[model samples]
Every structure is written in C-alpha cells, then in structure tokens.
Target: MTALPIHPDQRTPSDTSVPVSESFVSIQGEGKLTGVPSWFLRLAGCNLRCRWCDTPYASWEPESVSRPVDELCEEMRATGLRHAVLTGGEPMIFPQLLPLTERLHRMGVHITIETAGTVTRPGVRCHLMSLSPKLANSTPVGDPRDPSGKWAERHEHRRLNFASLNELIAGSPDRQIKFVVTGPDDLPEIESVLARVDGWKPDDIILMPEGVTVPDPDEVAWVVEACRTRGWRYGDRLHIRLFGDTKGT
Candidate 1:
C-alpha cells in the first residue's frame, strides 16, 4: 500500500491512502503502556490468521480501501493525541508505513507498533514495539480446518515470518513479548520462543488471555499465577473489558 497524496488545499481525508482498514483515537488497551491515549491506525491486511482474531474487518481484506497517507497523517494530528499505535493486518506489508511513521515522529507523537513478530524494518522507528509471536495454535494460511479455512488456504504462502524478530529486539527498550494463551495448550510454545531468545527476562514478557470480546477472569488468574512462577507479568486486554472489543472505543 502507498500513502495518499495531499490535496493542495491540505484538507485531507480522515484515513490514510496506504491501504487502511480504519483509523481513530483510543486508549492503548494492551501491552506495556495500557490505558494511554493513543491514535489507532489499523492497516488492511495480515499474513497470518490466528484463530481468535478480533479485528477481522481489518485483517481479512484491508486492501479494498486505499487511503492517502497525507489524509491519514492529518487525521492522526487532528486527534490532539500524543501517542499513536500502528497496528494491522500486518502493517509492515505497506512499505510506505516508514514515511507515515517518520512524519508522526516529527510531530512529537510517541509511536507504538503492535505486530505479529514476523516481519521487520529499520526505518519505522517506534517508541514501543509489541510483538506477539505466532504460535502453532495460530492457523497457518490455507489450513482448511482453521476457523477461517477458506481465507487461510488462499493466503498460506504469505503466513507471518519470524525473520526479523532479532533485529527488532536488538536495541529496543520499550518493547515486550505478548503471548495470547488459549487454555493450557499454549504455554509450551511460549516457553520455546523464550528459550530461543535468550536475555529476554520474564519481566519483559506479558501473558494475556485469548478471548476477543472479553478476557475471562479465571484465565487471567491462571496466567498471573503462571507468570509469578515464571517471573513474567500478566497483561489484561483493557479495551475488551472496557469497550467489549468494539472499534473506535
């Protein structure tokens, strides 16, 4: 996706032209900086199809709407918010996101990226990087039994790639590993990734529940106990509880 051109008058659209699904202002409801005012930019496509995806509107087919980047940036600035969260169907898919984010930085906005931990780029300098590593429970594209079997099968080749995790984490300070636990079955995968990524203290890892609309209190308690045992922290999806997973808060 490419950024949209600015109109000479400079009155731009609310969204960006870089193939956006939606954009608006909301509190950062997840990750390290939860409960912070942040402008949300949801991109239009994703490489992986997790079973419990909450924002299918954006992830399933975001390419259908192409927004101009100038308009999108203007939309963000108008919000009067100091923070911006760049999220996706895999936002890294849009090569132009670098320029979009760079402009945001120039505006003194603190930027955060919520990604699936597969792709990487050097220029999209975000202040906070929330990378959720895909697990086996995350359906690979094209696996028919996957809840969205039809969609997954068609996009299997474009499944999320873990090729950039190393570079992204090398010098990142305001970053965290967020793992969505689906019952007890998901813990092993988290352990495996942690073991591979040495020096990632448990304090830097956040275990969250997998519910889309709302997190179960029981699950949160279980995760908290597990984190206590492992020395990690438990993160709850604040938006899901406060807004029931609806868009635009």
Candidate 2:
C-alpha cells in the first residue's frame, strides 16, 4: 500500500483489547443482505469524521469501552445468529477484527466487515466486505461537530485512500461498494471514485440515502432513480425507519 500521512488519532489504538462502542442483534439493514437477521458488532473509533455521521458516539466523540475479541466472540455465539456484521466507527482501524473474524469464521458464522475502504486488511476474511467510501459532502469543513474546525482538512485528506481501497477490494472474494449519496449531483463523484478503485463489478455497487434519521421521501426517490438509471442497488436505512436511529436495533 502506498504511504499516506494519516493523523495520529485517525489510526486505531494499537492495544490488545478491542474498543467496542456497542454490539447488538439487528437485521441486515443495507447492501445485499438487506432483510436477513444478523448480529452487529459496532467497534469504536474512526479515522475520518463525517459531517452527517449517524453514530456520533462511535466517531465524533467516541465512547470507548475495551472488550477483548474472545469476550466479543462469546457474545456473538450467545446470539445464536448465523450472520454477523463487524461494523464500525471504521472497524478496519482496529486490527483485532482480523482475529475476531477468524474466530467467528471457525464457528460457522458468516462475517461482514463494514468499512470506509480507507484501511486495508490483507488477512481480513469475511463473507462480505461492505465498502462505504465517504464522499466530499461528508467533510466537516465548517460543521459544528468538529470543535477545532480541523477535521475538515484532516478528514478530507484521510477519507479517500484509493490504494488501500483497491487492496481491500482485491482481497475480499465477496464485496460491495456502498456510497452514502446526499445529493443528485454526487453520481459523478461516485463514478469517479469507482474508476480509481480497481475490480469492482456493477452489482457490487450500492447507493444509500445520507441521513441520521429517516430521509425525505423526495430525497429517497432521487436515490432510487439514480440506482435505476445506473443499474446500481438502492440501500435503505431500515434501522432509522423502524427504530428512528436509536442504539441497539
């Protein structure tokens, strides 16, 4: 992978214990496994901060609770669920996920790693590599979320790592490129991002409406239309619709 000057805080803490924000049993709300029942392992800490980050507790001001992989795996086994999602605050930052997924795979659990596609995990094994690359709109330039008003530049520079994204795409046998589209014009930017990343198929691309809560119907329709015209899949924030963006499904 090519070198990039990622900010110190942007990198996951190189500690033995995996930092967990929250873990729960929720339906697969996005991508191909939209309605399937699955266990969500929402790890804490993120490299980049999004302007409209839905899980601010896991990112903007992360709630860190150290939990070991064995303990986390035990929680998954207790769930009695077959499908599992290793999601984040950018889960890729936490290397413990590599071993965590490894353990889950041995237990016959189908794992999905939801990431921003900025960090590459060569040994990361999963049934699905859900890649959600943050777009330009996600930058917190003048956003109040960033108290120092510095993440705009920091996040913008660290957000899109094509080299790492390409490695991640190449490593995973099954993968999806999910983009959180906030406007109609984001299509071009999305297309441009796809061009830089190598070996992504048309079916692997998914477009999700950008919002913490339920998005406007008109906004959702535009995303649907974009998907129809481009032959990409439309991803819905079902959790937001059903639970109104609350924690733990």
Quick one: best lDDT, which candidate?
A: 2
Residue 125 of model 1, lDDT score: 57
> Candidate 1, overall lDDT?
0.72
**Per-residue C-alpha lDDT of model 1 across residues 66-145, encoded as one tens digit per residue:** 87777777888898998888998788666767678767877888888888767776556577778788666666445444
Worst 10 residues of 2 by lDDT: 1-10
Q: Relative to the true structure, how large is the alpha-carbon lDDT of every model? A: 0.72, 0.83
Q: TM-score per candidate, in order?
A: 0.83, 0.90
Give a tens-digit lDDT track for model 2, residues 92-154: 887676677667877988888899988886566677778999999899988876668788889
Q: After aligning candidate 2 to the native by TM-score, how far in Å is the CA of 215 from where it should be? A: 3.1
Best by TM-score: 2
Worst 10 contiguous positions by lDDT, candidate 1? 1-10
